[model samples]
Target: MSNIKEDQANFTNGFYLETHKRWEKFSNWIHCICVVTFDLELGQALESIYPPHVTLTKQETLNICYLAFPDSNSGCMGDTNFIVRLQSCPSKAVLSNVHTAYNSKCPPALQINPAYYWGYVYFRQVKDIKLPRGYFQKSVVILSRLPFNNLFTKIISVIAPEYFDNGNLSLEAACYNIDQWPTPVPGLTLSLPLLGSVFQTFIPHQRNSTSLILQLAGLNEVATSSENQIQASVEDLNLFDIFQPVLSHIDMLWELVITAEPLIVMASSPNHCSLMVLALTRIISPLKFCADHRTYFTIHDSDFKQFTNKVHGTPPVILGVTNPFFAKTLHHWPHTVRLGEDYGQYQKYKLKKNGNSKIFDSTPGVYSSYKPFLQKDKTMIKNLISGINTKRPFEVQSALLKKHLLELTHSFMIPLERYIASLMPLLKNISPFRAAPTPLPFNPDDFFAMLETAGPQLTTGIKGDWVGLYKKFFRSPNFNGWFNNRYTELALKLQALQLQALSDADLKLWVQGKPEVEIVDMVLKIKNKIKKCEQHDIPVSHTIKEQLEQRLQDIISSLPDDLKNILQTS
Candidate 1:
């Protein structure tokens, strides 16, 4: 049977109203999310089949990811992206987009043709948590579950579907971030790895549409991000602020794809790579970690799992209490106990302080239980979590990840540069006088006419971005002079052949032996060329005509003195 479950987040049984109201209380605006990706690598064999765009940066792909469950649909999920600078244009310096899945159906318009700002998104296969459907039935909680395979397929399909096809999706989540926090603390945190997908759909602006298309074409692999941890705490203790960092970990996912057929053709036409950078931002999950000590931590599913294990040994003694004293004693005491809700679950308990115990109302909202660990262990765990969550200490972890990403980017560029260097020789040795399969009678007028029609195509071969490549090649200090020299040699040879053929045809020598049928075929081909030129906005062919004639005259003058004098006399 298919494991796919109907998305519960889509309001079906009036459940959406309940969940929406819950998050509404904590909702904060003005969210800022950033994605930085570098060190992009393409398959060596694939590069030969479909060459990478040389006009843009190579190390420009990376992944970002986050976790999700019952409460949040567009919650913090992991995402992957590539960061690059435009070659010629200024102003917009970067391009960033995040990929994520949602339980609710998108708008009808967005499903087929998503808005330009929506970035790129695809439908993710989903399933229900079979047991959890009953577990939280007594309470207002609902936990949704979907397998990693479904998530992985959706992610890779958005990127280059042809290469990463049928990839195995494997992911594991631990109760705690082993690297940062080895032991269990009073608070909860989760560590999970997320799959990265490509964002291919982009708005059709002249600047970004072309470069983005080419960049995504060569992109095959989906980026898998490093494990990110989300920490949640509910401590009323003032001493906690001194020990822990301000934030535990910020999980953000960004996915974007560039798609525009017409723009791709236009931007890549000229010698200059129509290079422009674009930066766009969308709020995946906007959560502001409280900078003050009064802030309470909220745990997600991943973190709750770890918290469950730490208290698994100790049974919770459920008690009904309305007084602050009951909760205070529970806080001061040890052993896992639940006052109202279960421990290690995504429940935020309100800590209200009051001095009078006689007026203490016996309500189940306050939890009391025996402590699980020794006093020393408890202190250590609390201090470690606190220190990591602090602003300065958390930044250290973020910085380390950033540095690692940059190193990967540098490594990717080395092989890419080598590949481009290898192509220099082939580009230089292009033969201008190479004969076609069918040789037609030589006519200078026809040659010039074809040149006028195929102005850009004559220099740019099929499947090659020659003009963009040439501009980029000239900027390279190592190959600039050599490329110019080889290009000059090829241009001059082609010009000479055209001029010589024209001179011979005028003198009635070049086609003297050719039959009348051959001449007619050449005339037909020339007419078709002219027709094609009229179809589009033709560049100034007259300018090229003048240059061709001037070059022909210069070549004749440079000829040997005896030949030149004979030609002049004739």
Candidate 2:
């Protein structure tokens, strides 16, 4: 045991020592440059409030940016800067197509008032290091290790000169309960929800390759096909209850790289602020010109403005708070701009429930939903229940708890089961139209594996929990029927179209004399064949293998003499 303890201690110290060395090797001022590009009007409205400093052509709409990093456990000294601009976007083609799809009246030229913002953030703890070569720009600020104060403030006033005067910066915090309701803090507390409502807010965009590839494809419908939009409906949010009211304290230091115009007012408690940073980080991590995910679910700056101005009667400049904190107060921001409202005034629309007023855009693509079984469980319901008080008589408490558990089961679990059941048919139909010539058969076991992977997220309740409940339903006599049934065929034709589009685009690239593209095409084709056989639990026939090899040889023979010689030699 002593040897084991010594080994563990040695390993811990070694890990920290290595991590510190890596940090030292990196540039003192580590910059996470994310360029967020969005086409939707909601994205535009969010950007409208920023003071303009750059002009872009009509095709460009908005560039929402984060100027600096939060002082937290997030490895680097600082991160997270927010900025938005109208015009001059990298994804002009995608935005143009989206504009045409959504608005028919607009000309090929997307005319909008030119607007921009010059934002910068200097990290306090990064002062010892000098700026690296080629890092100068009006928008860029050198991060330093010195704390943000009047002295550093004086220095920035001369250097950056843009955000020298913005001072409406204030920190505010809100509370929430087990049900994600904003209950009063320190009382009326409950265990955190099994599925973290804020988990989506931490999904980094760059990490999701599907979104990035689709964004590059410049197809609006195809790129955003995974998204689901719905009308926002207000619910009774417990506005005061908060779980783990005390935030995970981050001992790092940072200065809010802010603007002086006072166009926006931000409020958030420490935890709330962390969630906000996390949400922003998740959404804009790489900030490639992809369509925003969670159009229905993730709350933005515009949402807070609408809630405060219309619902809560605390209308001010603008509000930038975390989704979890702000969600308890308002459902969504108004999509329509009033006649006389300027960018700032435009943010404060009347909070009337017009059914169409609010848009809930859900972000996660289909691939983002499931996790392997071995991952950490976010809900921790069983553990929480184990820690619960059982002072009452066993029979009475058990009976009451069981009834309440049933209610919860009926509310969330049943609907989830039904939703998953409905999707199985879609999954099954997809096999027929799969781009691959040899489509892999849909496996019930694979679906079951997905469930196992997502066990932690789906698991809920203090008693049987989500996994046990799902198993119970899975064992039901009619479950097979339910899982195999086709509910809606709207998405039936869509899968074929998606597959065709991908094939057409890839073929086009191959025809353009891109040997690499052609090689990739063949590789994918062969890979799919192998995958299909493996998934279906079948062996690949010799004839099938021979044909694939011949195709590869044909592709190689067709290569240019110089390339063919190089390939042969390699």
Candidate 1 minimal-lDDT segment of 10 residues: 257-266
Candidate 1: lDDT over CA atoms?
Answer: 0.23
Candidate 2 lDDT score at position 312: 57
What TM-score does candidate 1 reach? Answer: 0.19
Per-residue lDDT, model 1, residue 177, is 11
C-alpha displacement of 355 in model 2, angstroms?
15
Model 2 stretches astray by more than 4 angstroms: 1-277, 280-570
Considering every candidate listed, which one attains the maximal lDDT?
A: 2
TM-score of each: 0.19, 0.24
- RMSD value for candidate 1: 27.6
Q: Which candidate is the best by TM-score?
A: 2
lDDT of 2 by residue, 37-103 (tens): 2223322222221111223333222222222322123223322232222122343223222222222
